[model samples]
Target: MATFPLEPVHDTFRAIATTVVPEAVALDRAGWERLEEIIAEALASRPERIHRQLRLFVRIVDWRARWRHRERFVDLDPLQRTRELERIERSRWLLLRRGLWGLRTLIFMGYYAQPAIQREIGYRARPEGWDAVRGAGR
Candidate 1:
């Protein structure tokens, strides 16, 4: 059977992604699915060690929720999820903090990579530069 390696943590990543970028919560089903596919494609080009580290970090976030709140990361309320992520972002350990920031960078990349979001934000980059985009503004 064909499979996506990122499938195992997609749900956990969904919660983490939405928590990192709250606006993502408003995305429709197709948009969300595309976001996952995009993220998977991005990760696919990276080395396997980075892949393993990121997947482990995702699981750690989920387990940390249960350890601290007696609930899974996805099962937590929005407020709780935000607070949990914020705490991790401010973690004292250098590696832990780095991991959170790296994960967040990926989150932003996946979210902003959406064409709709790019249009909403008025971002249009053309190889020909400003001259090409000028007409699009009119």
Candidate 2:
């Protein structure tokens, strides 16, 4: 029931999320499964063009990993995977780096903003105080 074309892409994204967020290690099996589901849901809701672009980007990363290390990105050990991604993060091609950056940002934001995570981190939502700073004339 994945909105994406290939389930492997979801696996790759899960691997990437795990690599980027060490906190993910603390998640139980069900938590990890739910996290992957959350990421897939996020990708499914993007515009068509963006969805395709992100998919293509994952394919490219997979290819790059195999070409460089004779293994898929998800197959690489944690250290190797981190090193490879770091290389991509420093790419001269702005698009490649930016795409990964955007994906990483989305993954981290989604994971950390979960209500359970918020409570675990003691992140209490506060009422907006902007009214206090409104113009006196208003």
Candidate 3:
């Protein structure tokens, strides 16, 4: 069976459009219109592709958030509190800490990385072709 990240991509693109369009509208009506046109065209042509891109973008943002939080924990010197501990005790603490870090990294990478990888696979599997036009601006 084949699976796609269409849902994730759709959500991510919607998030980005929601966040960015407001700012664009504040620029000027013409600018807003132009942005709207671009968005409309993208949505009309390859909605699924845009959605996939958005999902990847969201995953990247989420990973960055996690990394920032992890940095805060590291800055707190979480390992320093265990000084003067026995070898076995220190080993156990280290194992647990390493396990947590590994798990976090895996999750972050898995969520963000798989979409792009899958997208490439999908693209190669089913390449997009040019659309046929029935009339000239009819």
Candidate 4:
């Protein structure tokens, strides 16, 4: 069976997303499904190694949290999850830290790219910098 965010690490991945974006905690079931679709789309074009790394890193987070908090990351209190993620973000291994950063970037991209979120944030395209878009089909 597949996990919602991505399997074999979706529990931790979802926990991480909610920690990174507290607003996500309030998302409805359908909203979470949509966000997962968006996140999957972002990963679909990546190299296989990227996919493997993400799975590995997410699992590592779960294991580390278990060691530190005596519970699955998904089961930890929100503050504990956030602090654990912060510790990983400050890891001495550069690659490890960058992986978390990449994960965070992905979450932001998936969360903010939703049409409702874009509208809520008052995002709109401005074509003034390059006239090509303004004149297209004109």
Candidate 5:
């Protein structure tokens, strides 16, 4: 199983929240502390399944960014990026299909909260387009 770093996830959330709610970010430290408390309380009420979905969401974004900039950063052949994106999409679909409320929450968050991230990172090619690559199971 793959895991994502928590700080980056949190930072991403903060960035999204700040963009969506500028007043929240404009607050002083004490105000931000209270906002954090509220957000924590809300998240605590959700099931653990949400965390799994969140992890997948973060991973997909990270992978998509890498894939989009593959030429600039590393020597990922077209085949390699295709295989990796397929793996990530499979994981995301599985979580979306089988996980519980947490998964649902994650989907909702992704739908609403992910536009900026997706805009920044760009989208992967559709799975079918990637199917021609070896190791990207149809």
Candidate 6:
């Protein structure tokens, strides 16, 4: 059985990811599964420092949820989760704010890297004029 990198915080991270990038919440089941695989792959490629930071971020989010609303981040209702995340995004502590930004960045990176999203955004691996430019030099 393969274990996920963020197993302990998977649900919390998924909620945060979908909340931060609302478009991701629109993904179908297959798309969501693909997103999970992409995130797991990215996490496996990173250094331990990044892995630790992500885990710590989940803990902080959970702690904040309990402190503010008496529930775990993953257990909160959608509105409450959104409110809590927004609060953290606006937190006075720079570290917490930055951490949330980092998490958002990772989520966005993985979400947008998918082929479907890439095409939707008109991102092509090779532009139409690339061959013309390359052949011109050749």
lDDT of each: 0.85, 0.77, 0.36, 0.82, 0.45, 0.81
Query: Model 6, range 47-79, lDDT digits (tens) per residue?
Result: 878888888988899898989888888788888
True-structure lDDT of candidate 3: 0.36
Best by lDDT: 1
Indicate the TM-score of model 1.
0.85
- Model 4 per-residue lDDT tens digits across residues 1-138: 123336577778889999999998877877777788887887777777788888888888888988988899999999998899889889998877988998899888878878787787797655575576567659
Model 6 alpha-carbon miss at residue 102, Å: 0.9
lDDT (10s digit) by residue, model 3, range 1-138: 123333344333333333322222133445333433444443455557644554454455334334645432112222321121112234556643443343233233333233343474463332333332323236
Question: What stretches of model 1 exceed 4 Å from their correct place?
Answer: 1-5, 130-138
Every model's TM-score:
0.85, 0.77, 0.25, 0.84, 0.38, 0.76
| TM-score of model 3 vs. true structure | 0.25
Task: Show model 4 residue runs off by greater than 4 Å.
Answer: 1-5, 126-138
- Per-residue CA lDDT of candidate 5, range 28-128, in tens? 65544444444444566666675556656645544554667654212344454444444544665665334323433433343333334345447544556
lDDT of 5 at 34: 48
Candidate 5 least-lDDT 10 residues: 1-10
Q: Which residue pairs of candidate 3 clash?
A: 9-51
Candidate 1 per-residue lDDT, tens place, 1-138, comes to 222345678888889989888899899988877777777787777787888888898899999999999999999999999999988988888787898998898789878988999999999777889888787779
Rank candidates, TM-score, best first.
1, 4, 2, 6, 5, 3
lDDT of 2: 0.77
Candidate 3 residue runs with Cα over 4 Å from true position: 1-37, 69-138
Candidate 2: worst 10 consecutive residues by lDDT?
A: 128-137
